[model samples]
Target chain A: MNWLMVVLGALAGAPLRYLTDRAVQVRHTTVFPWGTFGVNVTACALLGFLTGATTAATVPPALQHLVGPGLCATLSTYSTYSFETLRLAEAGAKFFAAANALVSVLAGLGAAYLAGALATALLG
Target chain B: MTREHPEDDAPAPGPEPKPTGWAAEPADPDTAIDPWPPKPGRPSRTPAREQAAILSVIALGGALGACARYGATLIWPTDPTAFPWTTFWTNVSGCAAMGVLMVLITERFTVHPLVRPFLGTGVLGGFTTFSTATIDTQRLLDGGRLATALLYVSATLAAALAAVWAAAALTRRAVV
Candidate 1:
């Protein structure tokens, strides 16, 4: 059951990331990767909510498996983030490269912290 | 393939000439998530059909990669208070693999258009997660382990970047 949930969630999450990336990328002209940044932060917030809910015992473990490991993990990607940073630096956009790495880490962590706090307050 | 004058025939025949760097490469979008920009002179397919095919491959690859990640965690569950070794290694290794794969597809080999979407964007993207890493750090901080959280976050970032850079450099030098 857990395995099936994970597969199903990934089937959804991966396609969603691709679509979101395309939609976001087309709208932006800046060299900064808002598409990947948007998806990663969004996933962090969602996983944060799920984690908090699980800790509060308000959500079932199966649901957590489906959403957390299955959905959020697939939706947010470290490899692409790092690769994009590498590409930026290689392209001589050193400032944007550094900003991309620093901002992404900070924003992702911030979103997770904020959403976790929100879920804990509401559910716990 | 012998050229009468390699300098004159600068446009070597392949998917694209080996990019010396991003400078030599065309000014395509730097983000690898975008589909390979349509090469000139190739027959165009129906846009909807191409998109559906790409999405299907991405879904399939994502499921496989996610399962492998889940299996790794199940096999090596971390203690609640301990660092997330499984996820850390997963991200680093996946980044390393991404480095090598990108060099190959872009420089060394001429792959089918869907290969990059499937392997790079789908499999490696699904395999290494940013959300889990950030949330795990958040959990550590919430538990009053600020030192551990800081170490975890910085170490993962540094190691992931270093791994990708080193992997790509080595792959370029050794393989290409």
Candidate 2:
């Protein structure tokens, strides 16, 4: 079952990653990968909500499995984020690279926290 | 330091004769050197067997990586209100591993092409997670540790990026 969940998550994550990357490329027309940042942040929030929901008295394990492992895993991507940052630095755009790094990390955490709180409040 | 070419210092001789192909003239000892070897061309289609092998490896590696990530969360237990150490360490360590692996695979090992899908894409992909990182940051803010959450997120992103760059740079240097 766990294996199944991982596979399903990956299937969802990979395509979403491709599409997000394409969208970012088309919109930004720059080297920076905004799509990855967007997805990672969103994924983080979803994960937080999943975690919060699981701990709550009303939520069930099945729900957590479907959403946490299946959805969040696919939604967030570390590899793309890492690759883009390096590309920026190599291109000598140190400031942009630094900003991308800072924004994703801080925003991701904030998003996750908010999601968790919202989920907890609503579900609890 | 000034460097001089020895050939340039030597006296010039008569004009060199133009080289001819094998069919045009007899093979000459001077023209025997082949600078570029003829490389075998790739097939028009990839073999099905190879594709299956790659997929299996990726799946197996992904499973292991995911399990390891899950284990990390369990090992580092923290309250929802406080900073989450498990997710932080998992991402950092995963990035570090990727850095080292990139070097090891490209430089040191004669890794099979399929190995990349399995280890690089599947295993490492599963090992490091962005979702957890994002959610953790949010949790920190919600829990009232706004500053810590912000700092943690920034540090993770910067460090992870640096790790890859450092790894690649080191590998290139080592190869050269």
Candidate 3:
């Protein structure tokens, strides 16, 4: 049952990342990977909220498996992020490459921090 | 990953000038680091049947990857106060595998388009998560383990990047 929930959530999450990347990349003009940036940060925020909720016992373990490990994990991809950063550097966009890594780490941390705080305040 | 111009695929009403900055190389769709905008001249909309097939494979691959990740955690659960070795190793190893996979598919062998989407975008993408890493750092910080938090964040970042670079470099030397 737990595994099934994870599989089902991933079914939605993985394709969502692909589709979201496709949508976001087309709208942008820069070589910077805004699509991945957007999804990663968003996933962090959602996972943060879910973590806080679980800590407060407002979220069940099953839901945690579905959303945390299944959905957000699939939605947020470190491999793609690293590959894009490497590609950017290889392509001579050194500044964008560094910015992509630095900014992503900072923004993802910030989103997680802020969302966790909000969840704790609301639930705990 | 080359910048893909949207106008390259979708029909345009007017003769708008293509944006400048990044050159759109006609890279093989199977080999692109990022799968967006779908190579330079290929039509964006594939047959509905093909699209469904691609999505199904991606979902199946994602489930396999996620299950493997979950299995790792169950096998090696970490204490909340201790370092998250499971996730750290998962990300590092996944990135390393991605390096090898990318080199093989793009540089060494010609493969079906679905292969990249399944293994690269679905499996490795699902296996290694940026969000969980960030949140793990936040939890450590919230618990007032400042030193461990900082160490975890920087160490994971450095190790993951180094693993990818070294793996790709080694694979390239070994194969090409």
Q: Tens digit of lDDT per residue, candidate 3, span A12-116?
A: 778888778767766655778888899899999999889877776567778888998899998888888887777677668899888998999999998987887
User: Which stretch of 10 consecutive residues in model 3 chain B shows the poorest summed lDDT?
Assistant: B20-29
* Local accuracy of candidate 2 as per-residue lDDT tens digits, A32-124: 567677777777877877777766656655556556755576556576567566656655668767777777777876776687779889888
Between candidates 1 and 3, the TM-score winner: 1
Q: In model 1, which regions exceed 4 Å deviation? A: B1-46
- Whole-model lDDT values for every prediction: 0.82, 0.62, 0.80
The candidate that wins on DockQ is 1
Alpha-carbon runs more than 4 Å astray in model 2: A1-29, A48-57, A106-124, B1-60, B104-111, B169-176
All candidates: CA RMSD (Å): 6.8, 12.5, 6.9
lDDT of 1 by residue, A1-124 (tens): 8998888888888888877876776665577888889999999999988887788766866787889889999999999899888888887788888998999999998898788789899988
Question: Given candidate 1, what's the lDDT at residue A62?
Answer: 73
> Which is superior by lDDT, 1 or 3?
1
lDDT, model 3, position A48:
88
- Per-model DockQ against the true two-chain complex: 0.50, 0.22, 0.48
Q: For residue B103, give model 1's deviation from the true position in Å.
A: 0.2
